[model samples]
Target: MGKSIFISLPVTDLKVSVAFYEALGFRNNPRFTDETAACMVWSEAISFMLLTHDKWRSFTTRPIPPSTSSEVMLALSCDSREAVDAMSQAAAAHGGTVDINPVEDHGFMYTRDLADPDGHDLAAMWMDVSPMPARS
Candidate 1:
């Protein structure tokens, strides 16, 4: 069986969050989506399950983090350095903050950080794995 990951996130505004993810290249799967939740596919193997605050609370009583608090930073691979930059720009235009962390560039890799409207941190990156230099 092929393995896949579904990262579940609690969102304050479902519609806006859906648009934010869509701009970053995720397509909503209406088959698994409704007013309370959305299944955003980033790849065949990677998807995000965005749930409304009430829907999230039904799953757990744990408190949701405030906009400034973060427990994780998700990373996404890009087709090229330019793709990474483009994603960052899209993020900024769609109610996200770009460069939450400083951009990084190695000879064979590039990355830029971003935060969604609800302050979820994500890093867009591209790497030439075959051309990567060995650590000395």
Candidate 2:
């Protein structure tokens, strides 16, 4: 069997967070969703479990960071440069903040970073590895 990753995040508002994730192309898996949490599917191997504050605390007593602070950054691969840009636009249109860091452009890859409404850092990127230089 293949392994998969399930990222758990604490959100202030369940519905809004779900919508934001959806805009970025994640689909809600109702079988794993409820009033307190939602399983947002990005692909066959990737999924995010967005949990309400109370629901989050049930699993850990660790303090939830304030909206202005970030502890980690998540990166997603896009099919093309246009897909990366589209995700940036979608993020801005939603409650998310787009381009938290300046855009990065290398000949083989392009990236744009954004932050969710709750301040989770997310990076959308597209890369062509064919031209990448091999390690010495």
Write candidate 2's Cα lDDT for 1-136 as tens digits: 4899999999999999999999999999999999999999998999999999999999999999998897999999999999999999999888999999999999699999999989999999999999867999
Displacement of residue 87 (Cα, Å) in model 1 is 0.3
Local lDDT at 67 for model 1: 79
Q: Alpha carbon lDDT of residue 123, candidate 2?
A: 98
- Error (Å) of candidate 2 at residue 134 is 5.0
TM-score of each: 0.94, 0.96
Off by over 4 Å in 1: 133-136
The candidate that wins on TM-score is 2
Report the lDDT tens digits of candidate 1 across residue range 79-127.
Answer: 9999999999999999999998889999798999999989999999999
Native-to-model Cα distance after best TM-score fit, residue 40 in candidate 1, in Å: 0.1
Clashing pairs in 1: none
